[model samples]
Target: MAEPVLAAELRQEAPIPLDLGFALHPGEVTALFGASGAGKTTVLRCLAGLYRPRTGRIRCGGETWFDSDADLWLPSHRRRIGLVFQDYALFPHMTAEANVAAALGHLPRAQRAARARALLALVHLQDFASRRPAELSGGQRQRVAVARALAREPEVLLLDEPFSALDRAVRVALYAEIEALRARLACPIVLVTHDFEEVARLADRVLVLEDGRIIAEGDVGAISARADLPIIAAAAEAGSVLDATLVETLAARRLSVLDTAAGRLVAPVIDAAPGARLRVRIPARDVILADRAPEGLSVHNALAGTVAAVEPRAGGLADLLVAVGAARLRAQVTEDAVSRLGLAPGRPVVALVKSVAVTRPGA
Candidate 1:
């Protein structure tokens, strides 16, 4: 394994004013996640030898690519990196194959074409080699761009919104394609995108940025584990979020488990051995409350919890926060239901959840 294509700490002012830090290790995907002006693209450009950070050291695969203190900077073309821009940056006058072949600078024309053909084939575009950029769809053009980047056998791969120019379905499918490529290529990979969904789908580790400096950094679970208060208040959904440990298989073979905060509870059986992680957020509106524990009900898991707080919602619906030991939950229910159930702060009630509501990733 080699070091990252570039490793450096950047200090900048603009979209966000401050010193920002990041590192890209070989064989790992690092995502610069932020909003429109969060400086994600700026960071990518700096790593690609485009934007020069006033104070930082950058190296590519153990080779010094850029050193600000040493007054040594390499041009983007000399960096031996594959950069896929948001627009694909294909030469419209040339066919897809030519655009890819152009990256093989010193190779003979025929050898370059063969290298281009193989790279294009890797991206599933062998037949489209002759197609000009104008003749290709957005997705096809992006694939051509990827093929061109790989043509150099880059020591590092940098992508800026590679999927943003395509349709949703195409973006998702292409992401999987890129993920497959990532596994096969041993180079360091860096992607810049504001779309958290993209990060969730593709990133092994996510770095959250706000106001230029990194506010959070960790795997998906760590970032999402924070109470939705700040993010939820921003997202506009009311739900009690819980992280559970998978317990065991039930007789019915439906998913059974212990709620993160509440004690033992079972839902429909899930396909997992003991000790799998599940993240579930139960919406407040789904929970039905009764003064006395309901008996002989269809709901499998009912836990007693006290009302934590009440939040006013649209259309006379109330968002209730219930506390089960340390487990906090948000449920959306009608004010009438709140009144009928005699629910208030500190009132005891049962929280009902279906097994299917538990969300799982392909772990």
Candidate 2:
């Protein structure tokens, strides 16, 4: 891995005990994923210099931001970090342009306005420059907040549930916008969120926190496939994330065909052009296993694979990891089904997935 652009080792005792360490590489979006009160936000705060841990060291871009042993602390304003809060923290009276310009205090007065406008244009909000936060929709307001953060020319970007306030449709649109912005800004980005779907869509890596400590950390696909982990097992949306490319769009059929490492899949019409890369989420509950191909069925996807593992769960349910080509698909079935199908590691099986059940995260 390349040298980490941002690194931290934090330790605390009171008000949510925390003991964790992590590093972020340039151009990598690492998510602090966990449930409420799991200390995801607290860790983000410590990194942003908003809260100092009892004993910790924070370094970014080869500069020390905090060192408890030396009793040295760099205040939030001094740290070259851009933060987008859960709530759009824009001044109600200020227009979108003014809100973004407020962060350009470090630049010359004459250059601030132009720089702010450029930032807004980057987020595709150039026309809303004169609109105040109250006049803008939730998604528009969030975009303004993002534009303001970019005006700081930060070395690291921190997003704290920035899309939580938006509805599903708006959130999906913002997901695409953020993905575009991320490619342009090659800085390390840290996202604090509890939504697994959000993590699957936007995060390159994930650190699962429980009781203020990191319980698991890995690439999003690996973490999502760990049914043995409490967090993954308990999530109703437990599933596998596959990297796929849009092969073509069948407008007449109202479906899009995608090619994945596992196999070809047909899904509901997606809004992207052909050849676009996408992340597809296949919920475990939506997958069915069969010993051989079924003659007649409405299922659009039937991938042949070998069983990799079986994790029995409460209520006699079992989670199976089926390896298809280079990818894995997770399927949840009853223990009875597992026995009847003679399911076990190395057993050949066919995984059935419905066209409508296949979802593109944030779509």
| Candidate 2 RMSD computed on C-alpha atoms after optimal superposition onto the true structure | 2.6
TM-score of 2: 0.90
Cα lDDT, all candidates: 0.73, 0.89
Clash number by candidate, in order: 10, 0
TM-score of 1: 0.71
Instruction: Work out how many backbone clashes candidate 2 has.
Output: 0
**Candidate 2 off by > 4 Å:** 247-257, 263-275, 314-316, 356-363
Please provide, for model 2 over 84-144, each residue's C-alpha lDDT reduced to its tens digit, 9 standing for 90 to 100. 9989889999999999999999999999999999999999999999999999999999999
Candidate 1, residues 1-363: lDDT per residue as tens digits? 444455677775654454676667767787777667767787778778788776666776677877778888888888888899999999999999999989998687768988999999998999999999999989899999999898888888989988887898898678867877887988878888776556555665667666667777865534433333343333333444456777777766555665476566676666666787665545445666667677788877677888877766668977677776666666667889888887799888887754335543323
Worst 10 residues of 1 by lDDT: 227-236
* Most accurate candidate by TM-score: 2
